[model samples]
Target: MPPSQELRRKAVNFKKGFKLKLEPEEIRKLEAVVEKATDQFTVEVAEKLRGLRVALNDVANSQIGADQAMQAIRSLSLEIKGMGGMFKYPLLTAFAKSLNDFTKDMGVPTPIQLDIIAAQIDALYVVMGNRIQGSGSKIEMQLLGALEEAARKYRHH
Candidate 1:
């Protein structure tokens, strides 16, 4: 991230779906996304990011057909770029960065990698959501694992 608050102010990424301005209500809503989480609400926060991930996937998988996958990916990329930083999930922000970088070439994904990414995203939502709801599930565990890997792998390049 940029060191200066001014840069943070100026540097919101629309491509990743970070809104340029955060309304107080939206900030409050977002803060509620992690109200139940512990440890600075990181778990709660990542769960909130899962909502974006699912939305991104929906945008990505909007099937005109297989060819439409590229359009969806591009659209999702912009959303990820735009929102990643604004939402304050630095690790999620980094995942968006990694995805934006990896998919820039627009090659096809193997079934396994596609499976991995999609499943992990789903898992993220379940786990993070569970934390807020006072519960846990198998999917949530998997999501946590995926997040751990993502947190480790995503460097702030």
Candidate 2:
């Protein structure tokens, strides 16, 4: 099966099993834990972005390393975008898709799409970084990141 279809299937099933624990206290605790996790996830994604920048900083210093970084960025960007779509977070998914195209265009430099994508990432960086860094955007960031991570693990196989 196509990876996308398989991921969607798994996500659907997982969502179905998310019943709260029978005890009220346990359910509340679970919610809190989930919330905390969500925030950390957003920050991690932001850090990953920074890592990409660091990796790409010396594109001229080592072309092979830069190329690998770019490839990883493309893969990670796609993974992020796919999670937004699966979870019905349209805005994030839309931006992620645009970002994915942006990284892909870096290789071919075609169709004038890279510039647009770059601008979008510049804007998103401000938000994603702030949220990831405990600037009050944690919950949203974490939810998005957690969802994406769940959906993308199969890709590593």
Candidate 3:
């Protein structure tokens, strides 16, 4: 048998990151900043919606770059999904998430799929245009339900 060797151990000093707690006043100030940024969010979302429309139109027209257009749609929807709830528009977040999910694996969408996409885009426009924040009204909920159902039913087809 070989001679036994002693083992050496090293201790690691893990440093704690920045403090996560915020004072009440800090929270209020942060909320005020968020509230003031809603107008900027509106402008950004409007621009993104315009890009969505242009991409959708490209897809609808059977352009040679349909794949790129679909990619653009996916990217824009994701951006919208990420920002909507931050501005207190959870409904917008929901709709954008639905759009993002529906188009996640899409390629050369069918007429019915295009129709669904168009409806989703229109719903987004209505939410932003009307400044419908939060979860919105009963009709809006119904619309969301219908869109989600349609997306689920036709996703694989």
| Candidate whose TM-score is highest | 3
Q: Which ten residues in a row have the lowest lDDT in candidate 3?
A: 4-13
Ranking by TM-score: 3, 2, 1
lDDT of 3 by residue, 1-157 (tens): 9554443123322454323577787788889998999889999999999999999999999859999999999999999999999998999999999999999999989989999999999999999999998999999999999999999998988
What stretches of model 3 exceed 4 Å from their correct place? 1-19
If both were scored by lDDT, which would come out higher, candidate 1 or candidate 3? 3
lDDT of each: 0.49, 0.52, 0.93
Candidate 3 shows a clash count of 0
Q: lDDT (0-100) at residue 42 of candidate 3?
A: 97
Sequence-dependent TM-score of model 1: 0.38
Instruction: Report the C-alpha lDDT of model 1 over 1-157, residue by residue, as the tens digit.
Output: 7467886667765575547788898888887775434354454455445554654465456533434564455455456445534444343444445455544554444444455446445543443444333223455445555654653453221
lDDT of 2 by residue, 127-154 (tens): 4544322222555556445434533432
Top candidate, metric lDDT: 3
lDDT of 3 at 142: 98
Locate the minimum summed-lDDT window of 10 residues in model 1.
Answer: 127-136
- List the candidate numbers ranked by lDDT, top first: 3, 2, 1
